[model samples]
Target: LIISSDSRIPSCGNSTLTGLDGDFVRRSKWTQLIPNTTEATAAAEAAGSSRAAGFMRLTSHRVTIQGANSATLQVNSGQMKMGMTYGFHLQVFNIYRGSNVGNSKETFLVSVKTEPVIAQIRGGDDRLLPIGSLTESKILIDASLSTDPANSTAKLNYNWLLSLSSGPTINTSSLQSLATEQMFFTTVPFLYLNKSSLISDSVYHLFLNVTSRRRGGKAVSSTSQVLRTTSTAVPVVSVLGGGIVNEAIPITLTLSTSSPSPTATYLWECTSQNLILTDPTTRSTSLDSQNLQILPSVLNGGATYTFQASVTIGGATGSASTTVIVNAGPVSGSCGGSPEVGEGLKTYFLLGCTGWSDQDTPMLFKFSTFSPTSTLELSSYSQLSSITTLLPARPSNTTIISSIQDSLGATSSFMFSLQVSQPDTFDVQDTRDLIKIRLTEGDSSLASVLISGTASYVFSNRSIQNTSQQASTVSGLVSLVDSLLNSSVSTTEAQVSTPLSLLQTVTSGPVSSLTTSTQGAVLSIVERTINSSLNSFSNAVASSTLGVLGNVL
Candidate 1:
């Protein structure tokens, strides 16, 4: 900075001592000084507050009176601080011995207002980097580490410029000729650009120009620095595939890259012993429908596996991996229970156990009975429940195909034969008569027989109070009896046999689950309706002398 005095004393409080031809004031008599109210002083104070150490400084401040009336004020910077600010008012004026600039004499400001806005650049790791490395093809340019020495409220405009070059030196004075390729502005002190904005093995220079106006619009400072970037671009590669699957399902994966070279090669690997990788040397590989259900004796049960893919691009190798989930297929407790069957309102209560997929997932069941005449009346929509009932109305040899499924659509199916025996043919009226006679007056008493066995459980959840209720309950009781004993079963000996072996299980001990009054009421309704007709028949059999009465009875 050079502060020059005019040949004529412009304005001052001291005596108007005008200088002539070659006369000049001594360095001691040159009492001229710039006051400390300039923007540079505010900038220095801001720099000191923002960081731990000094950023704005002058290594040398010397004054030399070159001519009789002019002088030069020198201010040089240390190694670290760089950008320059110029053409701002410094309040330079002629001063006399008695007329000091301020009340104190110790406050002379630096003549130059070196701009307080400093720009810096760093990588994602706080170091200059092409940081994201090769595989992901990413690059980060961060300018948040820059400095602004104005008031905290001042807005500094960050203008970034990118120049692709061949390691050329930068001339700060001729910055317009830097031949930049990309330029944009950001409001904050930080920003980053991606690898698509750069190339591999290429040189580039980054420059950030920061500007701000401070001191009530009286002062403005602008500064910038060239950022660092590496010559190599990140090599590009990607591996994609892996998802949830059920055991015994196939899996496929693919490896790819945009930056391929002649030396590029592909490799695949799977850590799981249960997994068999086909075409492991190619970019695409698969795991065929390998049953992933490992026995309890095996270690880890082999349900999850990791698939890795490696590829070389531009002489750089990168690897990627993903995890596949295999849920074990559902287990059926048995090849479907071989439960007994009956026809005509006979419900085949699946006697033994239900199937399950996993503890967390619900189970579903589907049944197929290969008999055209029989329609299955299911208790529910075939979800795995302990109380599943299948009603087949006609007798047939049914090849029942049953399958248990889970939420993920994995299923295990099995086949079993259900030999539904035709129920004894009877009219509703005849059945009522036969049941009444047998229970109330028939040789084998059965007033207590109907409500025994599984029917006890059925009646427990029902409300049975009247004769009509008792009648309906008895029908269900007969169905249970037939299903339990396979009672309608004929031709075991190709002829009729003794009846003692039948109905051994249907009688739940020798007692009924109903109250004594309820049992008597059921028997009274049966016997009263059949008593008159039976007495008339007895008279006929006794008087007509049709000795065939024995055969009818």
Candidate 2:
């Protein structure tokens, strides 16, 4: 028997190895037998003469072909010598000896239809549709191209080809040049497109081509609908009022838009050192309004604050940010001075002093003094100006109080005293010398004198003569001389001697030689003589001497 096998059967029909008809067989020839006694005797003699003469055996077998021509076929043979022939028709047969038919041989024919068919493409819910605007920059297209006869035993290969068109009429030539291709295993495939690649304010059409194929078979292709791409306006956000600011100052921030959106939502966020703000929408530091207010203490001194404003419209977002530098306030200064001030003297009392400030704010200075009593207030521009206050005069030494106030309401205090000296002493001996010179010069016009420099004295009563009358005369003469010195005229000793001579003439006494020691005696004698003459010459010389003394006194 002869058996033949075909390799092309599996490619013709859709059948698996398990479903193939194994009983189908094709037989081309039957076994033939011939009897030979002499050959049998020779074989028996070769095998040992005891072997009896054997007869040749012949067996007949039949094979049957089943099913249609498109069906799968399987064949089984027992100990067959097989020869294969490949031709236009798939033939599988075997040749075998009747004695060797106990061995087994099996062959399977699996009929497979390798042609893949793509019936329809199922684009999932995420596909770009023509109905609404597109807010996102990127879009995803999930497409599934199904094949006919879901259980077909064909090894299929799939490809997803994506193309973009600006208009309704898709130019296949342009699509081929710019198409994006990808290989897939299942019917489902994913495709992505960036809106930046497309023109703005224009419509774009997307086409998905799913190509399905099998080995040694024709490729099948299907396409999706024209998916139009839409675009929405992007909102632009801008922040105002940023940069350096002082602590405790109001910081206001406003958010504006270059392009307005109808359904846009706003959110403002802020962060600073040691600051917290409550919001109704969010528990964190966020606000829904476009304008935000940061009160005093919301931002600490020497710290930085960051702000963010975000606008969302139609699933699109626009954002802007800014920073604020918080500066510290003016620092406090120092104020102090001594405790005592001198009277009748120019004394400088320090009102206050301070270090340089970072800003240009005026400092206030105030000064007050007791005893004489004075007050003043002034504004200083420099770092340390108007710090000293002058006190001209005071009745006694007293305390001078002062204070300074800065722009930030910080104050400093100071206190000092003004000391007054006692009155100066008067000089008497110097006045006596001046009076003596005026009397010696006979200048009665010389009267009052300014006695200055070192000498101060008080005069007392003392006896100048022995007799009562002479002593009285001496005392009166000295009184007259003192009056002359106290007056504003220059008097001479000659002027005094004339009066004495008139007195001596009236006394009718001999003139004594006047020495420095007996000068008082001469004046006393002259006074006595004048009194005696008041009776003798009928008061002529007495009136003259008395008149001169009265004039001097």
Which residue segments of model 1 deviate by more than 4 Å? 1-235, 258-265, 279-302, 313-316, 332-352, 355-357, 369-401, 413-417, 421-553
Clashing pairs for predicted structure model 1, backbone only: 24-68, 200-233
Q: TM-score per candidate, in order?
A: 0.29, 0.25
TM-score top scorer: 1
Candidate 1: 10-residue stretch with minimal lDDT: 493-502
lDDT of each model, Cα atoms only? 0.39, 0.40
How accurate locally is residue 358 in candidate 1, as Cα lDDT from 0 to 100?
A: 44
Count clashing residue pairs in model 1: 2
lDDT for 186 in candidate 1 is: 74
Off by over 4 Å in 2: 1-234, 261-263, 272-274, 279-286, 330-333, 337-349, 355-377, 389-553
- Weakest 10 consecutive residues, lDDT, candidate 2? 451-460
